[model samples]
Target: MMIVALMASVSACASTYRVPREEAPPEWREDGKPTGFMPIEGSAKSFPGNHKERGVIMEFAVENERTAIITNTLEWTGPFGGSNIIPAGSPAYARQFSLRMSSNYGSYFGKDMNAYNNPIEWCVPRFDKGDAVCIFWEGSDRARYIDTSGGTPLNASPTSPSGMVGPMPQVQEQAVDFGHQMKIQVIVDTFRSNRITVATRISEGDDWSSLGRTKVMFDEGDTVTLKRFDGEFKLTAHRAGNGEITDVDVEVIKEPKAGRLQTFKDVLEMFMALKAAEAAKAAEDTDESDTASSPEED
Candidate 1:
């Protein structure tokens, strides 16, 4: 029920909020036969569209002395606890959504997925005077909760009148191989449309390759300058090459501008407020129950 619990809040605030782009993705097939593998919702929303739909995808080129704050792989999760809901009207929402959409799939690669504790992860881009692309270490930890199976049980008991508590099994994390280094690339286009497509790839030392790679387009906010790409982008186009679908690689040409960096403070504050409201409602119900159960008064 993580989806239900999280979506409840998202749905309540989604009246005017912009969700990821709703595009019909071509079915993935192998050797021209149907693979019957349809990605989960929100996975393919990384393509071009608008500020709300595609998130912040920036382009970078070689010889540019700017660096993007590469997302911390595996260990990091979205500020909203894997729930995609922020104040839709706030400027922070645009930055947060872009980060979440860009880095949501970093943990699906590698042989051992137990290293990550969060269900989903996001990153905020930063520009620094350095190389076109850079990698950074984010520290390592024991691998636990290999998959979503570690989530709350359907029949879990309530933690309080306002919240539910699930059993946290004492499954100690085991020593596993996890990549803490984040590799980033900013690809610039040929014409000036004020949009950039962010492409990324991950590799585990030489023995392995990209751990859940994806790219999405976003409008360069006021924080950065717009560089010209050769042509315009089609929001509804399918991402395929060589008559078959293939993953994009990390190739670059300069850093166009400085982008925003996302933090968890805003999301944490919102979640706390929602809990306070729930507790207040629960307390009111208790008062009514007490009055109903009282013995007849003189």
Candidate 2:
């Protein structure tokens, strides 16, 4: 019947050129490599306006694999402006994000990159992966990267190339509570010379103690004070040598009733009532010097 209708039209064009083999690709994928929740794709050539209500850019291609660890989760709504992209309960909402890694053969852009100018969207890390393997997010043009889970696991198996690797220096732990002797203020806005180390702990329960240690040497608008004896506290500020700490936190409450101790007790009761009227005029000049040396007083 005409060769079985040309063999059923070449088996329906080889079943439409079969294509079903993509379920082992997740060593790190983002920057428009989406297959599901699709929201990334050239992102309108990098946010082309409507005053940019949303924008997205995600790229993670750790090929010869050097290091490109990524984990991102975001949620947004409401009036949040910029100094560098703020909107999570503004006030310069700082949580953290500034992890950069680039390598076309390395020239720059990898020194444990976490250059926090004003980053705080979530834990963002880019452990320098130089040479080829990539992960890059060029400054927030209204930034956006909706989903990426965990790290390391995408296979093709052809391994043998690892060179540049840098990025592992983060120690942040802050716990503060003031309820007694209370006088805690630590405002450090550094620009240079900054070595602030203030530690305290008083939680009392099965063992949790150490309420002492203060070290300060900040520059810009520096203000440091610590006087505790009233509960929970822990503060740490670092950066005095290898420079790289933009700011630190700590602002406790309640301890404002001194007013110079009621203005020094109203100037010590007006100088003790003017020294008791000059001791009553020196006791009437000692009875007029004992009647002008006696005699003459007769």
Candidate 3:
């Protein structure tokens, strides 16, 4: 009865951005049951190009599968010590060094059912296997980071005037979900008065990169973040006495990119269906319990 709810939820949203089809439905899951994933076999691979060239391009169509795997977030390890590129913090551009957001950091194609085109150009910080991206719809090298602790509908409105979605909760370095396998781990190894050493590793191999150390000097008890270190996660730190600093927080950051885009009518509808499905399941359970414990009339 409650076998594949996640699959149903995603399929509902896909219809909003999904491509119409006349062919037979593709296989769902190995157990002949529906699941919220399509199979993806790829990694965040880089070809050629330096920091400003992007060396990578990413886009996906929800019409392709039930669970959409997309990449809208990009991350870089040390990337040759440090990157000159960072988020512009104005929403006008992705990074201070990039002019790609000409009022459209990302855009939608077609009229009826739209397809998402996220920016992955001039976005690759390193080609030495030190850069990565994350799944938004059609996943890139990895799957996703879903917060299961909260029951908030995925469509819950944010307080932002731009009407962006809610915030993405923070997950530990190597946190893994059921179907979404986290492929990157960014860690802070040494924290001193004036500098911090960072290490980033991918899940597929035993090697780790040393491209992410920060040499910025900070005073004790001062809290700060770096615009240059901004990506899918923010590197936040607090300095301690004697330079033997310890506590460092890496928070997830997500600011939606849009261009010629309107409301997510289809996704909202699907969210409603998901909520309804849960309610139905609860009602069914209650009815069964009532029937089983009912006292027979004399």
Candidate 4:
């Protein structure tokens, strides 16, 4: 009976399982198509003249990967001649500078999706007054936006919008069932001060609606863990103060023995408990052996 009970305990220990980490899908890439005039080029042009002359040129490139080259020439007639190169502050130079800035800035897509040749328009500024330019670059993800102007820089404090630029939180796998508890943890190094909230939602049909929201707070440099166990669902994060949001899609599945969806914490705890139980059993066995070897207490 003891052997059977020990085997059952061992099996239970072995049966302890956790969810595996989910691999986030690659970000979708937007198609890049030409919408405006061809970019400028760096080349020389010859003109009809009495004396042969050559000119030096300078060029500038814009967002569309196009270039615009400007040329300056010098001419001579008699024994000695002087040549002057106009500086950037000059009217001629200013005109070119203004043109380039306007072209590059105006070409930005306001709110209209059609104006943008790129499909990912999240970062694009909605053409309106008080919109400030905001740029976010992560790995291959590049986004530019015009945020609400008049406010301070987004990264003024730890809870500011710029502070969210750090590494993304860790995601855990979940099981699918009607009433089963599904817990998801998003590992973050630091949590914003202005009431950071994490929410879960499902992509029903086309749009995503809310499941619930949880507040996340952590000490300085400590990792913040957010857990949610409810009806099978998807999850996302949102910063209410800055209106920054993260959309994550997750699917729930049910398989006995809890597949790879287990988390590291759960596995570590189980291993530790198993080791402790084994040590206690060994001590008990040694005590029994000593008693059996001893003669009757006389």
Best by lDDT: 3
Order of all candidates by TM-score, from best down to worst? 3, 1, 4, 2
lDDT of 2 by residue, 1-298 (tens): 0000001011211111111122212222222221111111222111111111111111111111112222222233212321211222211001212333444544253332333232222222212211112111223222332112222111111011111122221212221111111111212222334554433221111222222333444434444333332222222334435665444444433222111111112324534544454456557767888888888535
182 in model 1: Cα distance from truth in Å? 19
Off by over 4 Å in 2: 1-94, 97-119, 123-298
User: Per-residue CA lDDT of candidate 4, range 263-290, in tens?
Assistant: 2233345345545655676688689889
- Residue 117 local lDDT, model 2: 30
Model 3 C-alpha lDDT versus the unseen true structure = 0.26
Candidate order (lDDT): 3, 2, 4, 1
User: lDDT for every model?
Assistant: 0.22, 0.25, 0.26, 0.23
Write the residue-wise lDDT of candidate 3 on 1-298 in tens digits.
Answer: 0110121122211211112122212211113322121223433221111111111111111111112211233222221233222222201101100011112332122121211222111111122333322211212222121112111111111111111111121221111222213233334555565555543322223332222222433324444332211233344455446645555554445321111111133223433554565567668968988999999899
Candidate 2 has a TM-score of 0.15
Q: Each prediction's TM-score against the native? A: 0.18, 0.15, 0.22, 0.17
lDDT string for model 1 (23-61, tens) is 211110012221111112222212232332223334221
Candidate 4: misplaced stretches above 4 Å?
1-256, 259-262
Worst 10 residues of 3 by lDDT: 90-99
